[model samples]
Target chain A: MRWLRLGALLLVVGFLLGTAVWLRPFGSPTAFEMDDYFLKNAQVEAGANNVVTSVVFDYRGFDTLGEATVLLCAVVGVAFILRRVKP
Target chain B: MSVVVRTIARLLLPWVLAFGGYVIMHGHLTPGGGFQGGAVVASAVALVVIAFGAEGLKGQKNLFSFLEDLGAIAFVALAFLGIGSTFFRNVLAGGGGLFGTPVPFGPNPGWLNTGGTLPLMNWAVGLKVLAGLGSVVLLLALFGGKEDG
Candidate 1:
């Protein structure tokens, strides 16, 4: 069992290290046409200086809505589990 | 913990809260946004919990829940505002109304009055996140009937 665990850890570490070494250089994306379009037009179209904020709240608002819903559910779940009962 | 810790937490609380508000308010113009700012504010809650213990925050869970609900409702309502054109259209981007200032192209100082619904959404999300995470910490601290120094 100890040897199996050691081998598994080594395999995972080797895979992660190999993947990191083979990764692309920083600041150079594999695909950036969409990013280019956003950079060029986000300010004018969304009227926001921050492109990332524009993207999160304007261009991709549905995703934010979904994220908000998920947070709501989580809070509700926690409240339910921790509610105090009347004797 | 100690009196020193409590005093420091009290002194730093307002500054942390102000920074969080700044991050959320300037989300459309700055690197930080609603989520990041909310997390920062939530840290203040944790600090309070750690310094003063869960007993200090008794009976505040409902208030957090209410604020979270309010934030969620405000967010969805803002999204519904642009439903005339589309679900999430930038309807007020250049409308010259509330939060409707148009942004200039190229690099320049960012305006706070611009971004239309973006800033509103940032506030809504910030409120929600702060309330939710703060309440979570409070609840966890209050759980199991345990007390801390």
Candidate 2:
């Protein structure tokens, strides 16, 4: 019974994924453009050439900081949960 | 099943690791980023743990922690330089060098040595993800492996 339910869920998810892949949203732009405009500008300001690097460390640095914090919390959580702390 | 699987994973692990490193180093000039490359590296380690058992990866505990800490420190130190100028500013390499001599490298963009704090942040992320993911896999494998007695 559980296996059947799992199979059903997988089938549903696969259908949804396939539908989304083939379906286009209403009036979406056909052409793609660079989303790293801020990074491009930051290159001159930060005196860095790599746009992605500039974005990560200079332009969108707060995001990077948050990402680091997330990693720290995850590591701490893993250590706490796995620690050989006795009752 | 066990022997065949172990043989295949063992054969593939080194190649996976090398490709991960290549992706990481060339991230500045390529499409893949630190997280992608780091996960690949960690996945390679995970394969080894799966094949050889948790004991095989136990020797790497200290190395993992060290890399994580060093990456964090390098990232923060780079940011602190920007504190006086602007948050996350590339303030270093303005001028001055050892014994009043001109520095070998100074504020330039696009080169490997350039990018200010970006490369440092990338290295930090690479270390953190690689270590964190490997550790997670190790713990799961250790606790999950058991045979009915």
Candidate 3:
């Protein structure tokens, strides 16, 4: 039973790792490069000094907002959990 | 509470804060930014809390909360500025610079406060990080110990 569980866990991990390796979101483009687009538009559109910040905040502001929301949710979750326990 | 450790922490804390400030301000030109510098400053606070105990940071929880709120509000406000002109726009309304100077020249392509919302963002983040991390650690320290019933 323990061996079966271990094998199943290993199989799942292997499948997930293989999927991640095969699918690269930031991979090189076949035709046009995304970095060029980001660099060119970031300065004019975002008006940010840092390209990375522009990418994080302006170019993908919606995504960044979602990320911030995730952080907020995590903080709230921790607070809720801690509150339930006696101090 | 060892005297040597306390003395060392005292000596190092101010420098850490100053360097963190420098990193936050010069984030536009340099590699380090608001989050990195903020974490660095927070780590200094953590050091103080660890070496001196939670009592060292006592009575400052309110202040920390204020800083955290300020940072969050500033960030959100900057984002909302997009509704008018552009998101995170450098809309300083004219009088803008370090210590209210027009423009303090630094290196090329940017100034000390060249990045408009960027510096404000840095300040906000610094406060948030220092406060947020300090509070979390202090809370843990307060509740994690084996208290006599």
Candidate 4:
């Protein structure tokens, strides 16, 4: 049984290695049109020097909103779980 | 826990809180942002829990919940400000009111008064994250199967 588990683990690791080897090199973009646009106009359009913040909070804001909601839900759930029951 | 640990925590607390504030405030110009800054502050709160225990925490959980709701509401309201054009629009940018300074193209020092709705959103998210994470830490410390020292 132990050997079977070890064999499975090895198979999974091998698959992951093959996938990683097949993946494209880092820092190489397939297209630059969007990147070019953001670089050229983020400051003027978003009116912020930090393009990353503008992108996170402005360009992709709904995602951030969703993230905030998730966090809120998690906090609420934890609070509920920790609350003492009258029973 | 011990006197030495407690003393060190006391000394480090203010600096942690200040650094978190800096990250949130400088979200538009630096590497950190509302969520990141809030997490930093929350870590300080956790440190307090570990060093002093939940009994040492002053505020109630209800207060933290209220602050969390307030942050969420304010963030949504700010997002709606952009609805005049589209959702999440930068309505305040270049408008010369609040956070509306127009920034020139290229690298510069980056103004605090710029970024229109960005700063407002950052504040909202920062508040939400701070309260949310702080509440989580407080609750865990309160009910973690170990009595407060």
Candidate 5:
């Protein structure tokens, strides 16, 4: 059983390695149209020096909203799961 | 908890909270933003839980949930502030109002009052994350308790 578990772990590791090797080189993207546009215009348009912040909270505000919703649900889930546990 | 653990938590709690506040407030000016800052604050809460146990957190779950809801609602409301142009349209940029200062064309010391609705949104996210994570961990700790605190 131990050997079987080791073999399974090795298979998972090999698959992960293969997937990593199949990906493109680091720091190089195939498409820069949108990225360039954001980089160029994010400052003046978003009025924030941090381009990433502008993208997250302005250009991609909907995504951030969704993230907040997700966090809410997570807290709710934990509360519900432990609802019966009295402190 | 051990005395050393309690002492360390007491010493570190204020610093942790201050760091979190800095990250949240400097979202537009620095590397860390709302979510990152919220996580930092949540970690501080966790340290308190670890040192003091969840006994003190009793009855606080509702407060956390309420604050989380408030954050979520505030974020959505702020997003709606741009309904005049379009959703998420930076209406405040260059308007010279709340978070509406025009940014220079390049890198400079960023202003706090310059992110339009972005800073408000960052604050909303920070509050949400802090409350959400703190409550979740507190509940889990309560569940794992071998006896009531």
Candidate 6:
């Protein structure tokens, strides 16, 4: 069992190191066409100076909605669990 | 916890709140947005809780819950506003009305009166996050207590 664990750990480390060595260079992405479009047009279309906010609240508003829903659910769960019970 | 800690928290409360408001208000123009701002404000709540106690926020749980509900409703309503074109559409952008200023292409000083629905949504989400997180903390702190506090 000990030998098995050591071999598994070595395999994982070796795989991670190999992948890291072949990683892409910084500041360059494999696909940036969509990003370029957002950078250029987010301000004009969304009318927001911050492109990240435009993407979050305008282009991907549904995701924010979903996130809000999740937060609501979480709060509800906490409140329910923590509710005081009458004797 | 102590007098000094409580005093510091009291002094810092307004500044933290102001910074959080700034983040939410300038979500369209700056790096911080609704979620970040809301988290900032919620941190203020936590600071208060730590300095004082869970009982310090006694009787305020319902208010937080109500605010969270209001924020959720406002966010949905804002989304429905753009349903004429499409859900979450930028219908109010460049409309020359409230928060409807057209932004000039390329980088410049950011205008506040732009990103119509975006800013509204930012406010909505900010409220939701602050209330939600603050209430969560309050609930956890007050849990299993003698009373609701």
CA RMSD of all predictions? 2.3, 6.5, 4.6, 2.0, 2.4, 2.3
* Model 4: docking quality category: medium
| DockQ, all candidates in order | 0.62, 0.28, 0.23, 0.65, 0.63, 0.68
Per residue, candidate 2 scores C-alpha lDDT tens digits across A24-50 of 885785654555455335444544444
Looking at every candidate separately, what fraction of the true A–B Cα contacts under 8 Å does it contain?
0.74, 0.38, 0.12, 0.78, 0.81, 0.86
Local accuracy by lDDT, each model: 0.90, 0.69, 0.66, 0.89, 0.86, 0.91
Give stretches of model 4 more than 4 Å off.
B146-149
True contacts kept of 5: 0.81
TM-score of each: 0.94, 0.71, 0.75, 0.94, 0.90, 0.93
Please identify model 2 stretches exceeding 4 Å from their true place. Answer: A1-43, A46-50, A85-87, B92-113, B144-149
Best by TM-score: 4
Greater-DockQ candidate between 2 and 3: 2
lDDT per residue (tens digit) for residues A1-87 in model 3 = 999999999999999999988875766656657887866655444344577765654556566556555655555555455442543
Q: Which of the numbered candidates is closest to the native, going by highest lDDT?
A: 6
Worst 10 residues of 3 chain A by lDDT: A78-87
Ranking the candidates on TM-score from highest down gives 4, 1, 6, 5, 3, 2
DockQ computed for model 3 against the true two-chain complex using alpha carbons: 0.23
lDDT of 1 at B94: 76
Candidate ordering by lDDT (highest first) = 6, 1, 4, 5, 2, 3
Candidate 4's interface RMSD, please? 2.8
Error of model 2, residue B56, in angstroms: 1.5
Query: Where is model 5 more than 4 Å wrong at Cα?
Result: A1-12, A85-87, B146-149
Top candidate by DockQ: 6
Clashing pairs in 5: none
lDDT per residue for candidate 6 within A1-87, as digits (tens), equals 999999999999999999988999867789999999999998889898999999998888888888888999999998888888776
Q: What docking tier does model 2 reach?
A: acceptable
Clashing pairs in 4: none
Q: Give the TM-score of candidate 3.
A: 0.75
Candidate 2's displacement at residue A82, Å, is: 2.6
